[model samples]
Target chain A: MLEFILARGNYWVIVALMMTGLYISFSAQNLIKRLVGLSVFQTSVFLFYITLGKVAGGTAPILIGEDLAGHHGAGHEEDAAHGTAAAGHEAPVETPAAPHVETEPVVEVDPETGEPIADPTAIDPAAELAPDAVDPGHSDIPPLQGEDASLMGEPLEDGVTETSDYVLSGHDGAADALHQAAESSLHSVYSNPLPHVLILTAIVVGVATLAVGLALIVRIREAYGTIEADEVRNIDIDVALEEEEAEDAAAEGAA
Target chain B: MNPDHHVILRVVAKTLIPLITLYAFYVQFHGDYSPGGGFQAGVIFAVGIILYALIFGVSSALRLIPPSFTRGLAAAGVLLYAGVGIWALFGGGNYLEYGALLDEPEGGHHGQHIGIILIELGVLFGVAGSMLTIFYAFAGRVAEISDEDW
Candidate 1:
């Protein structure tokens, strides 16, 4: 029980919100307050679905590029090729720098020797040092580059990338995940797109329902002179009783 | 209603309204690459207009966008959405196949891009129109309810 509670705390909070919204919508006297409650309930449901779709370290559903590796392959190859070409010379590469090229850019081509210089500022001290101690250049290199590169490529989260298939084919495990994520750092993602697509339609439908409900409430207020449910019910009951009495009188008079 | 003046609010609103609309368009167009698309953008767009209505008075807002136009827009938006699907059908593909939007089904992602944009545009119109219409309906009733009724 403790393990379950600890693992799924967000679910508990969502339930609480859902219950509060349901209670308010069902029990509130004022029509507008009820609508507000309904809105709250709708919002909570949205949150629930969003939360469900979230992975431990996932990006949004948007596909930055279809062939994630190839997208950055061209850039990396160009940089490497430029570095090799300029090995004998001392001139900066003329490629339009990646949009995400940071201020203290990492793995930058050195201006003096025109060699790739990994910036110390961009590297995490812990990740860099820890890996070097166990295996100097093999295992630690990729993960460290992954971590730094992921952070460097966050600007593409806004938009303006090539379109491709949204669903990424599953890879093996942590290393593959890290590699894929690091390679296409711009489109780093772990979240499912299915939920986002489903919710897109639901949101519009939800708004339509809210609009119709509001319209009904307005009409009700105009007819009964009150939006309170109890008041409206009482008026309806009185009208029913008056009709019954009039019908009975008419029957007696005809007899 | 009492005539009031708040220079700060008016100035701030003036600045924010254009920014909000701009952001909404950004979200709409950039949605394929980001987390937002038509629904979210439309709501944000409607919110911008709604803010204008609240600040400048419903009468002025309604004058800016008549209720009749909103009704027409709502229907037109649905038609636009359906039209895309019908167009696809005529193109010899399943309804809303999207790949059919392009002349060459084997071409590339351009057809899908076109299809998504059309649907999103439809959604933008539908959502924006209905939201504004609903706001108008609610605000229109204010005159009928006297101050004492509250």
Candidate 2:
């Protein structure tokens, strides 16, 4: 319920800004005052974008070294355990002295041995040719696998595939996660474009309005030697009365 | 305006504007990890300037930031924002796809941060200057008319 209220709060703020802008544009005689109102309205939208990007319990997606290491360790452990268990036998313990086997292709020669260091984990040979890949000239030594797991005494589960938790959540958790993911993705995609387009449109409209308002101010200055809104309105009223009298006299003369 | 009035208002404006602008920078820089961001901070900073203009007379504010400079700043901000999109395009990605800014697509977060900061700066200038400009335009007209009557 709290989340719902927070989510809708932005919409309410936008509505309020809209109403304020409308009121100021229609009722405020001062041209600059109207621009202020328009800006207030535009700002409310910026607020909306900032609010939408917020993720619950998610840190800024910035990956720190610790975070990267944690993820790498978890993934490596999971893969090694699963692979060994699927083989139906205890995997041979890897020793530090054993030279690592290369599983991937090498594109460069080692400076020391003048031999190409194979990339043990290169999934693609074409990727090996990429300039940014780790220099193939280094010793193609693969890290000892299962050594860490052996130290921990945790038998790595071989191919212990758990059923999708989505099915176990009895539909609610799965649905919620999916909904949240979709919303976040949508927000990410639209957050950039929406504000840019809206602000641009507001600016053009603002400029046009400002131009017209300035022109009116100029005209008011010429007619009454004053550009003040109050003075212009008073002068306009007097002129209307004179025109009305002139029109009445012309009609009487026609009669 | 009285000297005292000028002093008081200037003190207030200086105090508030810097604090608000600092907060804006904080939000813009930390946006990747927080609830605050460029757009929100920009508006707040603009409001702070508007408040300054309101407290001090329009003429005083104009002296601090001329109308022509404000207009130029506003335009420059928009140009900077569009330039980021253009940069992304040149970097071999779709428009605004900051990932393409560098050779490693995964390192695109850095590019995104740069793009966001540039866009936020644009928003800050445009909002603050235009708001101040509007205040000046109305206040000038009103002052001129009132003086004529006197």
- Each candidate structure's TM-score, on Cα atoms with residue i matched to residue i, is 0.63, 0.43
Span of ten consecutive residues with least summed lDDT in model 1 chain A: A156-165
Candidate 2 colliding pairs: A85-A158
Q: What is the lDDT of residue B39 in candidate 2?
A: 56
Give the Å error, residue A171, model 2.
24
lDDT of 1 by residue, A135-187 (tens): 11111112223421232222221111111112111244445544544455354
Error of 2 at A85 (Å): 39
Q: How many residue pairs clash in each candidate?
A: 0, 1
**Residue A243's lDDT in candidate 1:** 100
Per-residue alpha-carbon lDDT of candidate 2 for residues B87-141, written as tens digits (9 for 90 to 100): 8788876576555555343323566556666667676666656655665566555
Once superposed on the true structure, which residue ranges of model 1 sit more than 4 Å away at CA? A57-189, B1-4, B142-145
